[model samples]
Target: MNPNGRRGVELMCTGATSNSSWMKQLTSASRQGRHGRVLHLFFTSLRPGDRGAADTHPAAIPTALRACARLGDASSGRLIHGLVLTRFPSLASDAVAATALLDMYAKCGLVASARRVFDEMPRHDDLVAWNALLAGYARHGLPERALTLAIKMRGQGLRPDLVTWNAVVSGFALAGDDQMAGDLVRAMQDDGFQPDVVTWTSLVSGSVLNFHYDRARALFRRMVAAGNRVLPSSATIASILPAFANVTDVKRGKEVHAYAVVTGVEQNLTVSSALVDMYAKCGLVLKAHRLFDKMAERSSVTWNSMIFGLANYGHCQEAIGLFDRMLCDGARPDHLTFTAVLTACSYCGMVELGEGLYRAMKEEHGIEPRLEHYACMVHLLGRAGKVAEAYDFIRAMPLEPDCFVWGALLGACRSHGNVKLAELAASRLRTVEPANAANCLLFSDALASAGRQDDVVKMKRLAKRRRIKKLDGCSWLESP
Candidate 1:
């Protein structure tokens, strides 16, 4: 028979007896670079009367399943699972096929189904199965379950390799269980397993998440001292560099920068962005600007970091200017970029510029203004004694006004002594955030300012009844 005729005949054998022939055809199709066709042919062969008894081969179903997963075709994956159940339910007992199924389910975000397959496996005793389930749990944000599963795997006499340990450690780190992640690292060491780059990177990420810059630094130091020969990636440097931004110790931040240079990651986009942020937050905007300018390729995140850093340091004009430069450079501004720019405009009391930018954000850039943006606008209007305009803006917001938005109007009301506006703002504020002590205090202060002593007394009584303790105001100074 010709190849086409043979393929047609192959498609007609759907029963279990055709297992061997199906396996051979699958191999031939794969070798010929027709993976998708191979999957289609396999499933086509399994349809109703076409399935041959030779299709009972243990490896045929898994081969098809793997192909479906590789294609990322969820429908194909489900069809293969159905084929497995229909033609050869015994194939589910195959450890390799079960592992493949677990992987397919996990990749498709069907973790619950993956877990079911894992639980139903008669031979759930393998490390591969355990690792697959643990990885699924981690990927789906069930790190706690992943951790528990790891312990159970160990208890059940499965010797987890470095890959397994890395998964568990990374899972704990992502879940914000830094201490448990650290303990796992220590446990791995105790078990005579030398931690790899993945182990260190996971720990570093955990430190970054938990704001433990010092611990991250210490881990990096240890990695260097050991001379284990694994270099930190740009992503790793990016992850830890931001923590050093707010750090009082510029000396330490400089050390990390030096390391980035030594590791040849200084030109890395993420690392460069982080370095800019760190230097800016350390009151070294000039240095930040110098680094930013030196970058050959800058991402939008890089621009945002520099713009936000400038805005945060009270350099509103420069921040706005940088924002314009970002646009000139054709870097698209995300929501965060607009928030920074709007905040800068508010702080500088550039109401006209702020309003223009706000309108342009929606009209020109298609960016929807969020509550924070509205709050900044309200504050700007209130500062200029445009209380009525501010109130109107709140009412006209695309979404329901949040407590912060209402509080902005309340603050403006207090500043202008607009008793009616103040009462309206307060009533809306109370509805949105009833237990907010700041809102309550603002309302009471507004009542007092409006000469409503009886109302003020009543508000104070309500405040006392709610046991709302005033927050202490504090400030700090950093030596540059």
Candidate 2:
């Protein structure tokens, strides 16, 4: 019988002693980015002398499955799992292979299939399989299920590992349950699992995901002070740098850069990009530019960071120049590159330049204009007092005009005191964002500027009736 599917493990395995060799071969294949070779090796290969039972060898399914997991090749993983079934004749009952299979399927976003495999397996008190299932649930946005499963796992006499604790913490963090996430960290400590750098890193990334920037920064500081055991890794530092940038805390961002240097993570591409982005956001475009120039290698992300940083600081000429350099350097501009350059054109009043780039985005790059790109264009036209042209552009939009598009138009109207256009923009904004009072206030101000006191009175009454509350305005400045 030729080797195929579930009945082929007898042909695949020769001896248990070959586990290390099998792993070394598969791991090498994975490192070389030979996912196809991995597939062929597992799914189509026949080992030496495996045709006879006298030459039978044990196969290492777990190691091969892990390589597949790392490469995100679930197709290869499933084939390996099928071979495990035939060789062991108890695939579902085997803890090691079952756990790996469960993890691979979960990471591939096939949770239903993962759960099916878990259910088919005979119940056991092992923690590895249980943790895999819990991680799958957590990673797939089923945090409640993971939490409940954690309780269930404990009831079955299984102890939670550091991964299990990390899953629960990360789940709560993603769910924006900061209190619960902190509680789990304490519980992990009480359970005798010292929080590693990964543990803190997860919390930091989660906080950023959930928009808790201040908390992310605090976690970064704690991670830095974690003694000799867990100094901030490049990832931990990279994660926290953006929080400081978001808050415009340039002083702290500088401190993070210094920390990265001492930790030897600053020289990494990811950390370097984050540093460039941080400096740019903090109004240090030149610093960001210098850092970009010094990098030995550049990815799309690095180019976008420098472009966005320059554009955001109103350095239209420099930003657009850098964009040209990026293309010359064989770096293809993404949607974000266009957005940044277009934003620079808007702030600098380079209308013709902006329009040409917009056309280039579609004709040259084949990238369609997204909402943000359109919004930037609208602001570009509106900021130049071309109220009528901006309004016509909004009318001709391929997609339904969203709040940001109309908001940009309304702001332009407010700037130029175009009462008629402002009223039109205000109507759309009110329909789309009824709860926002800024629209009403802007409309009233625009009407008053045009000496339409009665219209202003009516607008104020409308705002009062709707009970729309205005958001508080706040600004940040870096200290001297």
- Top candidate (TM-score): 2
Model 2: what TM-score? 0.77
> Global lDDT of each model?
0.79, 0.80
| Stretches of model 2 off by over 4 angstroms after superposition | 1-29, 32-105, 108-110, 120-129, 155-157, 359-368, 384-386, 469-480
Candidate 1, 397-463: lDDT as tens digits: 8888888888989998887889899889888987888777888787778788888999999988888
Number of clashing pairs, model 1?
Answer: 22
- Badly placed stretches (over 4 Å) of model 1 are 1-133, 148-159, 212-233, 359-366, 427-465, 473-480
TM-score, every prediction: 0.67, 0.77
Model 2: per-residue Cα lDDT over 177-255, one tens digit each: 8898899999899999988887888889889877898788778877767678788788878778888888778888898
User: 273 in model 2: Cα distance from truth in Å?
Assistant: 1.8
367 Cα displacement, candidate 1 (Å): 3.8
Model 2's alpha-carbon lDDT is 0.80
Q: Distance from true position, residue 57, model 1, in Å?
A: 26
Clashing pairs in 2: 14-56, 14-57, 15-57, 15-58, 16-58
